[model samples]
Target: MKFRVLVAVSTLALTLGIAGTGAAQAQSIAQALAAAYDHAPDLQSALLSAKSSAEDIVRAESAKRPTIGASLGGNYNWAVGPGAVGPGGTNPTGAFTGSSTFSAGLSYNQTIFDNFATEAQIEAARAGAEAAEYQIRNTEQNVLLDVVQAYMDVMTGQQLVALRQENLTFFRAQLQSAEDRLEVGEGTRIDVAQAEARLAQGEAGYRAAISSLEVSQATFQRLVGAAPRNLSGGHDFSRLIPGTLQSAIAEAETGHPAILLAKAGIRAAQAGSDAAQAAFGPNASVSGQVGTSYSTATGTSSGLSGQLGFQITVPIYAGGALGAGVRKANIEQIRSEVDAMGAYDQVRAAVIAAWSGIQSADAQITAAQAAVSAGQEVLEGVIQERDLGTRTTLEVLNAQAELTTAREGLINASSGKVVATFSLLAAIGRLTAADLGLPVEVKTAVPYTQTVEDVWQELRTVAD
Candidate 1:
């Protein structure tokens, strides 16, 4: 009966994470990752933030455009006595005593030039938006890596639970054998007691393993957006990883989103410095207004009044605020440069560490496989020797316990290998749903940027 159950459990393990197995569809890791990309609120928030950041480009670009406005107003006046003569007026002797006045105008202002200050601001905003877009990629990688780890955790948890159950069954059989031998005068009560102790310990371990599996399943559900079922365990990302640690580090330096974001930050800070320096240069603009108004008391239509003007303003001093801004921007630019350099170093270290983990797991899996085989052989030998009256029931139980531990180690090593390989891929910035060849459309922030940059953006809403 135990063997039949073990066989069924092993079969279930092999089919875990595959679809179309049971009444409920089994979700593959790829499907889980895709679902997470669609459903993760954190990722969704990051994408929305990227969209918001892209609007800054539109706002900055507005400075290059013209602004138009219109206004109207009226006032009434009643004279108590004759008005005195007004200087520089058509009716210099005295103005009309009871005249109502009205005015209306359409005004326009355009920034003809500002020493490229607005241009620098636009460039800075564009760079910042690009950096924000890359940050979405970083968030994508984070969510995908989380899904991978959670999936593997569920797979490994199931394996552990199965191993514990088998160990418990083995100990129960050993206890039965010990009691039988004691009844036949071939063993002492001590042997039965030892077997009972092992059985109790095995039961406790089995219960702990089940609890852990439940926790892992819950975590998997939270991340992948579905309960784990039929999770096939051949999840390996080593193929997507670089062939060597040095190559991995080089890839990370070039492609890591953090490093790219830092580079963009430097460009944005430099543009800010440029804009601040532009404050020292002469500013130029043009304005025009056209209007016509009529007053009821005068009973005359006021002819159109219009004026066009050009202006230039050069800053002589600004209470040191402009200089301070320039200095602050320069400092930030330098800091961004330093941050880019530091980002490269940090990414390189992560790649190295993740690569080392993969290499170590490879060795561990190999050694653990050998250990499990040896343990199985040892258990078989001890069982045979006990049947031949040369070994005690205690020895058989010890051998079986060793075999169970060895098998558990193998299971853990396998899981570690899978997760570490994925970590290495993520460190080098290639662990994406598209990179995995998942059958889902890869979402990108480029569409938002493109729409914002369009010359004729009549509709302001982003496409769904």
Candidate 2:
């Protein structure tokens, strides 16, 4: 009875395991991308960096605003003083102590002029923010490409496993037929042995295919934080390829995130140069303060004071620091120009490569399809001849092997075509989840509330 219970439990566990696997296999590529977009830590970090960069604009602008501040304090004081005595004679007295003193003040300042440095800084900050935004887009593109590739890999692996299993089934049936013929004396013992060997080879291939499929699935799961369930149907690559390489290159030049980022960097460097030049110009400011004080000896008093100031700062003697800064900025601008040129070159190269890959894979697919058809026809003819006793068992086995190879080759060719299509889209900067028609579950910003600029403004107001 104990042994019977153990068998029942084991059977239930096996059934449940298979059921779970089936469930996992039903997830789709769209679902996986959605999950990754929502939860991937790397993407989250990129988004945060973009947000922080945006706050820099506000920080730069804060220099132009008026600031106000207040402070309150109390103090005790002791002092020795000369006192008035009788008959108009002055006398040195003992120490006199004051028990309480209180003071409070409010102050304000405004920047009247600053040689346009503030404006230049704001421009630089805006450029930096734009660069950061491009970086976010670039990171998103990379993530999408990775997810698509991993998802397709899993699908290809699964398809290969299914193909191998089907091939194995055909081989097993053939082996059984050969065995029957041998038992009836219509075939020799060698024929049966050959069939058995083919069956063993097919089984080994099937196992290897299954192992590859498992690894692919694991990779997909690791990327998306969940196993992909029912994937989308086969891709249609007809619409992906551009009519001309020139068109693709043009699109990449205008739309590529990397190129955009480099351009923004150049603009930022220009702004930095402007700011350095502005260091030689003048500045003006205004300040005011109001305060009340209470003391045991002087009683309570209140006063208000205001000052309008205009200060001209000439860069007369900085030991060449300003010139060095300007030189440094010029060098950075040059570097940015080079980087932009490099981006253009990279995009051009990628477009050419992707276009070539697409054309090659398309031709390969056509040839593979024809080969599969020819191989199938050859296999059928050989089998018919064998059944009529005109062909040997070894001939039939060889035909079956040829058919298997043709089918596998066709699958690989199809996969290559699909991959090439996406590569071309990536080269043109058009590879996106939206372009792929993927479903997005959530579209929202990060969780943090107060921006860095907001906090900086509050602190500046207090300081004033």
Candidate 3:
């Protein structure tokens, strides 16, 4: 009885382990996107960069605040005196003494004023943070688009394989019928040979389709960071595509990651310009120091020194460096403006292209669907005629071939429609995992601006 119980427990464990392994292998596209979102090194790097940019605000504010430091040391000295022996003077005297001294002091220097340069720098840092945020959004959009495209490619490839299998099955049935007729002398040998040739061709096509499907699935797995399993058929893309080109362009302008990032660049450059202008203004500072000193041969002494003063730094001479900086900043600002304008044009072009593609794909899908239906009807008629001895096997085979082609065409059209919809969304910067109903962890916004303001307040206190 004990042995039986142990065996039963072991069997249960093995079963559960196998089941878990199967579940792990069967990942959906949505799950893959979630995995990519969590595990992608690039996204993690971008987040770190954003955090680093945020830290820049702290560094900039530090420049306006009082800095405190301390120091300590010890020393030994030896003295020698040479003189003639007369009237309280020694002929030659040499003395050596060692003394240990320690001192610790805290000194503070605060920038009382810096012509708003520090403030401008803080603003620039804020803009940099915003740009980083936009970059993250851009990365997310690109990832989602890639996931969607790869997912659809896999699905379409699988559909093609299925269609090929169906065709092969039909061909095999026809071939069997033709052989039976030929063996009974009801059909000519040519019919049997033709059927055999058609079956061989279909088997080859099926094998090729299967190979293509596997390749597509593998590509999808690599992109999503996991193997895809149990993916449903393609989505209804009609709702995703805008009805009008104007609407599509408007959406792209409003939401496109590239456009937003470019706009952020313009703002950052503007902040830089402001900071450069502030460099020409006056700067003021206040300072304080306190120290305690001890000597081995002398008593310890401690004292505190405080200074409250204001200073204005006027840029008197820089050999044209300041002017050059200002000129460079202005040039950058202009360049950023041009880039932003170019981004807008690019967005518009993408929107228009996607819009046209969606329209064309929709028409193709409709036409393909109609063709598949008509082809299937014709194939049924041909099969009936061949069975009734009114149609030749060759004609029936041709009908089957046409029907297979039509079915494959329909699948391609459907897949094209789905891809075009995603392309449109990506063009507008609105392509995201959430839009596709994929699982992802949404981050809560940190009050970065408020954090910067709090640090600036502390700096003001130090300056005061």
Which ten-residue region of model 2 has the weakest summed lDDT?
441-450
Location of the lowest summed lDDT over 10 successive residues in candidate 3? 13-22
Q: Candidate 2: which stretches are off by over 4 Å?
A: 1-32, 79-96, 181-196, 235-241, 306-308, 433-464
All candidates: TM-score = 0.88, 0.80, 0.80
Candidate rank order under lDDT: 1, 2, 3
Q: Considering TM-score, where higher is better, how would the candidates rank from best to worst?
A: 1, 3, 2
Candidate 2 residue-wise lDDT, 274-295, digit = tens: 9988877877777777777777
**Best-matching candidate per TM-score:** 1
Candidate 1, residues 280-386: lDDT per residue as tens digits? Answer: 99989999999999888868878998999999999998899999999998999999999988998888888988988888999998998798778766777777788
In angstroms, give how far residue 431 of model 1 lies from its true place. 0.9
Tens-digit per-residue lDDT, 323-431, candidate 3: 8889999999999999999999998998888778878988987887788678766876777777778999999889878867776777777777767777888887767
Off by over 4 Å in 3: 1-35, 76-96, 181-197, 234-243, 302-311, 388-390, 433-439, 444-464
Winning candidate number (lDDT): 1
Give the alpha-carbon lDDT of every model. Answer: 0.81, 0.73, 0.73
